[model samples]
Target: MIDPQQATPRPDAPAVEDPATMPFPLISDISAARWLLVFIIAAAIYFFHGFLVPVLAATIIAFASWPLSRSVQRALGIDRTATAALFVLVIVLFLVVPVTMALLYAFRELQQWIYWVFEVNANGAATPLWMVDLPQIGDWIDEQWMRHIGRPGAIADLVQLTSGNTIASIYRSVLAAGNVAFHLALNLLFMLIALFVFYRDGDKIAGQIDIIGARILPRRWERLSRVVPLTISATVTGMTLIAMGEGVILGIAYWIAGVPSPVTLGVITGIMALIPGGAPLCFTLVSIYLVASGSPLAGVLLFLWGAIELFIVDKTIRPVLVGGPVKMPFLPTFFGLVGGVKTMGIVGLFVGPVLMALLVAIWREWLREIRTHPQTP
Candidate 1:
C-alpha cells in the first residue's frame, strides 16, 4: 500500500476459452425431434396428394412469373402489390384467354367441318382430281375416295359410323372438360393466393430459405439458390418465346394462303410448334389440303413459308428473347422439352429443361470449386 505503482504483479489472467474447443450443446436430440415433425408433415402431405398438387402448381407459377412481376414493378414505378396484380391480369389475358378461346374455336370448327363433310358426301360427285396428286399415299387415297363415293350406301354407312364415334368422343371429352374446369379454377385460386403471399412477403421467405440453406449446406447455399431460379427463368423464357414466335408466323402464313379457318389452323400450328420437328406436321397437312382444294400454289407457298419461318425466325428471334448470357447446351434443352412433355405432360416441357440446366450448372460450379481448393484428408 506504500507504493501502488510498484505493487507486485497479479497472477496472469485466466486464459480465455476458445469457442472451437468448447463443447456444443446436445443438438442431436433437438434435431431428431425436428426431423420427426418434418416426417409427420410429409406423410400428411403425401396422403393428401390431391390438395398438394394445386399448391405445388401455384408455387411453380409464382416462380415462373416472379421475374416478370419484378420487371413490371421497376418499369412502372409501382409497389409490389400493384405489380403483382397487373402481372396476374396480363397473364390471364395473354395465356388463359387465348387458350380458352382457341378451345371454343376448335369445337365450333370441328362441328362445322363434320357438317360440311356430310353435305359434300350427300350432294357432290366422285372425288376431286387434286386428291390423286398428294405426296405420300395420294394415289391410293384418291382410289379409295372414288370407290367409296361411287357407292352412296357405303358413304352413308361410313358417315353413320363416324357420326356415332364422334358423338361418343364428344361426350367423353365434355366430361373431361368439366373435370379440367374444376381443377383449373382451383389452381387459379391457389395461384392467386400464392402470388399475393409471395409478393407481400418475398423478402422474409428468401431470408428463411437462405437460413435453412446455410444450416444444411453452408458452403454452397448462395450459389445453389441463385443458380436454381436463374436457370429456371432463363430456360422457360427462352423456350416459350421461341414457341410463341413460331406459332404466330405459321398462323400468319396460313391466313395469307387463304386456308379455311385460319384461326383454327393457327391454333393447331401453335400446338404443333411445341412438338419436335417444329411445324412440319401441321404444314404437311395444310399443304395436302391446299393442293386437294385446288390451290397448289398456296400449298407450296405455305410449305415453304413454314420451313423458312421455322428455321430462319427461330434462329434469329430466339436469341433476342432469351438473352444470350444464359448459355445452356442446345441438345439438352431440346431433349428436356421433348422428354419432359412425354413423361410429365405439358408442364414438364418447361420443368425438364430448367432442372437439367440447374443440375449441370451446379455440378460444373462444384467441380470448379473443388479444383481450386483441395481438401485436407
Candidate 2:
C-alpha cells in the first residue's frame, strides 16, 4: 500500500546537478569565434594608431562646434552637408592658414634678428643710455657690456667657438623636421575628411550613441547627454578666446616697449597662453630682457600690465567660463591638463579637462547611488 503523499513521480522533470556532486569536466564558454574577433580588432588598431589622433581631433572639433553649425544652418537655410563642408573649410583657414603665416612671418623676423646680431657685432655696439641710469647693478652691467658685447666680432667669435658638428646637427634637424611635417600633413588631411563626415551625419551618429547609452546606462544617459557637449564647447571656446586675447594684449605691450618682432612674439605668446603658466613666463622673460637691456621704464610697465591683465583673466574670467558649467574642481582640472598633455600632445589639452569633468560626474553619481541604496553585508 502506497501513501497518497509519496505516490506521484513526474516524468517531465529533469535531474538537477548540485555543484558539490557534478560529474562532468568544465569547458570554456568563450568560443573560437570570440578569440578570433578580438585578435582582428587588436591588429587593426595597431596598424592604424597614427590615424587615431586626427580622427579624435575631428570628433572633438565637431562636438565643440555643433551648436554653432546648427545655428548657421538654421539662419542661412542651408543643408547640413553644405554647412559642414563650409565649416571645415573655415576651420582650415582658421587653423592651418594662420599657423602657416605665423611661421613664415616668424622665420622672416628671425632672419632680421640674426642680421641685427651681425650688425651689432660689426659696429662695436655700446651700452645704452638707459643702462647707465640703472640704480644698483648698472655699473656692473655696463662693464660686462663693454667687455663682452661692446666689441666688434664678439658674436662671430662666440659663434666660431661653438661650431662643432654644426653641419651634421643641421642635417639631422632638417630630416627630423621633414618627417614630422609629412606625418602632420597626413593627420590634417584625415582630420578634415572626418570633420566633414561628422558635420553631415553627426545627429544620426549621436542618436545611435544615445540608443547604446540607454541600453548600457539607462539611469545616467540623460544626464550625460546634457553635460558632455556643454562642457566640451565651453572648454574649447573659452581657452581659444582667452589665449588670443592674451596674445593681442601682450603683443601691443611688446610693441610699446620697443621689443623687436612684436607680431611674432605676440603669436608665440598667444599660443603659449593656451598652456598653464605659459603667458606669464613669456611676459616675465620679455620684461627681464627689457630691464637687462637698459629699458627699465618699459620693462617695469610691461611687467605690471601683464601681471594685472593675466591676474584678472585667470582669477575671474577663466574659471567662470571653463570650470563653471561642469563645476569641476581645480585638482581634477590640473590633473586632466597634465595627464592629457602627457598622453595625447596638444589635442589632449582640450580633451583632458572634459574627460576629468565626465569622470568626476560619474564618480559623484555612483556615490549617490551607494548612499541611496546601501548594500547589505
Candidate 3:
C-alpha cells in the first residue's frame, strides 16, 4: 500500500517541468534535407506561374459552368459525362462559331476593299466620295486621293505603298490568329479535362475546399468561395444575354434599312455591343455610307433607328439583364464595360464588373465584422 503523501499522481495534473524550459530536439540532417526539397518544389511552382495561367483559367471556366452542368444533369436525368459534353458543344456553337465567322468575314471585306481601291487607282478614276467625306479628315483625304488616283505616276507609287501595307497587315493579322488559335486550343483542352474531373468528383472537390477553408480562415473562406463563383456566373450570363439581344435588334434594323452587308454590320454591332461607346461608330459609318451613296433618306432613317435602338436597349433591356442580376449601379456598370474593353479586350468587359462586385462584397463583409465586434479600449 502507498503512503498518503506518495499516492499516485492524477493523470490530469499539470507537469512540474515547464515546456519553455525544456531543451528542443535537434533536427536530423535527412529531415532538414527533405524539408529543403519541399521548399524548392514550392518555389519552382511559384516561379513558373505563367505556365500555369492557362490551367488556372481552365479551372475557373470549369467552375463557372458547374452549376449549369449539374442543373442539366438533374433535369434530364443524364450522367455527368453526357452533361459536360452537351455543355461544351453549346459553348462551341454559340461562342466559337460566331467569333470565327466574324473574323473571316472582316478579313475578306478588308481584302476586297483594298482590291477595289487599287483597281480604281489603276483606271485613273476619281477617289470614292465616301472616303473624301470621312469626318475630321475629309480635307486631308481629298488631297491624298487626288494626288494618288488622278495622276499616273503617283498612282503607281501609291499602289506599291498600299500593297506593301496591306500585305504587312494581313501577315500580322494571320500571326495574331495563329497565336489566338494556339492559346484557345490549349484552353479548350484543359477546360475539357477540368470539366470531366469536376463532373466526376464535384462533391469530393467541394469537400476538399471545405477542408482547406476550415484549415485556413475558419470563417470567411467557404463563404467567399461560394460567392465568387456565383457572382462570376451571374455576370457572364447577364452580359451575354444582353449583348445578344442588342445584336439582334441592331441586325434587324440594319436589314430593314437595306444596308449593304447587313450581316457583317450586325456582327460588328454585336461585337461593339460588348463595348460602351463602340456601337455609335458602326452606326455612324453605316450612315455615312448611305449618305455618300446618294441615299440621304435611308441614311437619315438608319441614323434614327440606331439612336432609338440604343436608348431603348440600354434603358430597358440591358438594365433588366445585367444590372438586375448583378445589382450593380448603372454608372459603375457603364464605366466597367468601357474600362474593361479598353484594358482587356473583349473578355475584360465581363471580368471587370464581376471583379468590382466581388470587391464590394468583400468590403461589406469586413464592415459588418467590424460593426459586430468593436475593438477593446
Quality of model 1 by C-alpha lDDT? 0.69
Candidate models: Cα lDDT each: 0.69, 0.79, 0.68
lDDT (10s digit) by residue, model 1, range 1-377: 46988886678867778999989876787898999989999999889765544454445556666777777788889887787677667767887677667667766776677565556556645666666666788778877886666444555656457675543455467557757666656756765677677766676887998998989999889778887776666655665546655666777788899987776777666655554554788888888789778888999989888888766755766667565535566576667667766754444544566667777788888998899988989
Candidate 3, residues 1-377, lDDT tens digits: the string is 77999898999998798889977769877799989989998999999654454444444556667777888889999887787678767867886577667656766766666665556655666667777776788789788877866654465566458775544465467557767667656655665566567666777888897897877788778777777776666655555456656666777787888886676677678766655556777887888788877788888888898888878766776566545534556566667667755764445545566566566667777788789987999
Weakest lDDT window of 10 consecutive positions for candidate 1: 50-59
Query: Order the candidates by TM-score, highest first — what do you get?
Result: 1, 2, 3
Per-residue lDDT tens digits of candidate 2, residues 1-377?
99989977678888777989976555444666678778998999999887787887788789888988999999999999999989998988987677657666776786687667768888889898677767898899889887767898776665556775443354356446656657667877998998999999999999999998998789878977876786567767666567778987999899999998998899779867766677999999999889878788899999999999998987888777766433456678778778877877655665676677667766876788789989999
RMSD of each: 9.1, 8.1, 7.6
- Which TM-score value belongs to model 2? 0.68
User: Which model scores highest in TM-score?
Assistant: 1
Instruction: List TM-scores for all candidates, in order.
Output: 0.68, 0.68, 0.64
Give the clash count for each candidate.
Answer: 0, 0, 0
Q: What stretches of model 3 exceed 4 Å from their correct place?
A: 1-65, 113-127, 130-176, 179-183, 248-252, 255-267, 304-377
Task: For candidate 2, give the lDDT of residue 241.
Answer: 64
